[model samples]
Target: MWHFAVFLLLIYYLINRRNSKYLLYPPGPYSLPIIGNLLSVWMGLKNHKYHHKLWQSWSKIYGNILGLRLGLINVVVVSGRDMIKEVSSREVFEGRPDGFMYTMRSFGKKLGIVFGDGRPWSNTRRVALKYLRSFGYGTRSMEVIIAEECSELVKLRASDSGQPVLVNQMFNISVINILWRVVAGRRYDLNDDRVKHLCGLVMRLFRLVDMSGGIISFMPFLRHLVPKLIGFTEMKAIHASLQTFVKETIEEHKASIDIENPRDVIDAFLIEMLSNKENAFTEEELYVVSLDMLEAGMETVANTAVFMLLYLVRDENIQRKVQKEIDDVIGIRQPSLSDRSRMVYTEAVLLETLRLSSVAAMGIPHMALEDAHLGEYLIPKGTFLLMAIHDLHNGDLWEEADTFKPERFLNEGKLVQDERLIPFGLGRRRCIGEGLAKSELFMFLTHILQKFNLRIPHGDSLPSLEPVDGLTLSANPFSVIFEQRSS
Candidate 1:
């Protein structure tokens, strides 16, 4: 009876919402009346592993923006640099797409501020940026935390007594401590069970989204009403774990409020939450907003570092270039912000790493809040524009863009920036934690390389650079030797 009812509902929706006649909706390969191009998307997506092929397949036919549907919802995939730049520039399409994955995993409506659009996102972003700067995000204080975490990581790896450790386990603990410093204001050693719990929760949340088959977007009604009817069983466990962790952290901050010297992000937010309960800061906003930084900051950073090292282990030439640049600039010592400019090739390597291995393959989806003109199409209000960062990164608008040639970023042996590759994204909805993510990647990777060279496990072949599916393109496990680098 329930299945029949859902079928009837889908049929009803197909008739009413299946109209893709809008001039602005952009044309693509056809979808079924009810499913609306989902099968087409699934067909092109390889290994359920590489979903970028879905965008690549359609983009080959439809220049930049291609529209498809995940059941009832219409999705516009922005596949080129021009389309992404244009759509992202529009304030109308500035908020995160609402769904079960975003809600349950991203801390929607619980203690985070990512769901809402328009004035609310703007206001929250403004204050949050201020708080981040206050917490010394780009300064030495932030670097100090990353350094501390790296030290703990070294100690833990060293305890393995030269045996290669499965980097996923070790790197995750290091990543969480960095988040702890950013959000909670304290650094935890590897021995801390809290660090272990943080990693566990992050992985659990990742798994929920990974297994969903885009069904959360397809069947929002099921998730909103009967979650069990859908496949988000682990979601509840993930929610409870994350919520408890966040609530406890925020409460601990409340108990130990220091008006004199605010140390961490929580302390700064606490001051704001206490002062402005009405306008800029609210109790709900503080908890959830901090939750946002915690979640977004950790996952992306960790994934990126892991990918960079994974690539470095296989592509020894690139790794050697990075190390040579680091050594030439900062010497045999640890890298510092002062060495930031001097480390030209290191900087280039980082940029190329981001470009080749974009953490968010199809970046985050942005929703149109108001109708807007985009090229030959006029996007209506409430439409979604999913930016295919993979296309933008791989496209050869720049020479030899597909290959991981770090030198492409260095003109005449000096580092430069490429506006074409917006890995952290662009415009109002750009990642707030960009600065910290960059810092963590640089510090963590350089620290590891300075001490040990990353190589594929003995007798094991180099791992493929192809990415697995999820919100981010995480490189799967490839055994490697963390052989000590010569002094």
Candidate 2:
């Protein structure tokens, strides 16, 4: 038994050495025997508070295409605008990294649009986009849905009696309702307790799982050995809650089905599940996909809206400028989708918020389907590709990258379409809800500013601009007094 175990270790070492010799991988910090650069990355995260910034610091030493290994898995970190674009567009770099966390979220298999790869992902994404669009996604009808929700939100905030409201999770239900109207054909009340609990769970999950996949991805054994200590228990509890919610919602939809005329994405998926014989289109897929839509849709727009408000509150001049634009174009009337184009400064403010905040700092990791050449380096097959999205936005590509200058997005008082400003990402795997998110941001921000003057509490100091880093970037806990504007 001892001889066999030793033989197995020798063979594994041989394979690792052979793979390294064959490919001239991108340069990175020295990798110790079995652990690789895992310690360095872990420490980087500890010091930097953000994976994107950690990778950016490494890129300075190793150049744009930095390579490393986390445990036995080979990984490559890509930075710079052109390099990231190249990786994103290439078909070979379109696959997603597989791990315990990816599967844990999707009922012990890769079934959803976010992490699923190969034909399953392509098929799921296609059907999702098709049905979502059919049900008013990215259309003018979505504008009405968002507008109505904005009205409800305004009413809720107005009832606060000009008190400072902590906005970290404030927009969760409102944003979720907008997506729910399209997905499940229903919206929750802004103050729904269950919705609030679910949103809290989602945010907790965000903080627990970073882009690097955390300890579970590298050492699955740790989960069993020290489950609670490594956050496995809390993560499992969150998933269970999410699964229960999704399961109940799907079951409810199943009970009331109108095959001839589907109500929303859920009804549409149920109809598809009945007809499609493929494994990808099933009841399980429906559950996971629904959760994906809600979690992805809710988090991005809500966090971004909060970040925008935070920035505006921090800089009163920018706030006044955006408000002036709103008053000039929207007047006393509610802002419309058509007003977005005319509100150039307001649009620039939104663009700058996206650029600066970078909620999804490190985007969903992509895997190399085959040996691919990224820049001058050879990215090995099965290597997980991490794009430095936050770094790209804050890199040398922009002048005064750290500064909150909305004018960066404007040229001669017109919104300039800069390819470098890819908040929604690029290529086939880019975020599908870009239009919906944009519309929500525009409507929510404009609606709030139109009705209220956002300010810090009466005696408190200015709220910190430093973001709470997670799977996404979120503003630290801060409150805003929504003082109603005089008519």
Give the top-scoring candidate (lDDT).
2
RMSD to the true structure for each prediction, in A, is 3.0, 2.0
lDDT of each: 0.72, 0.86
Would you list the clashing residue pairs of candidate 2?
none
Best by TM-score: 2
Question: Residue by residue across 110-145, what tens digits does model 1's lDDT show?
Answer: 225555466776777777777777767677777888
Give the per-residue lDDT of model 2 (tens digit) for 231-308: 899999999999899898888999999899899999998988777666438788888889998899888889999898
Quote the positional error of residue 195 for candidate 2 in Å.
Answer: 0.7
| TM-score for each predicted model, relative to the true structure | 0.90, 0.96
TM-score of 2: 0.96
TM-score of 1: 0.90
Model 1 lDDT at residue 81: 73
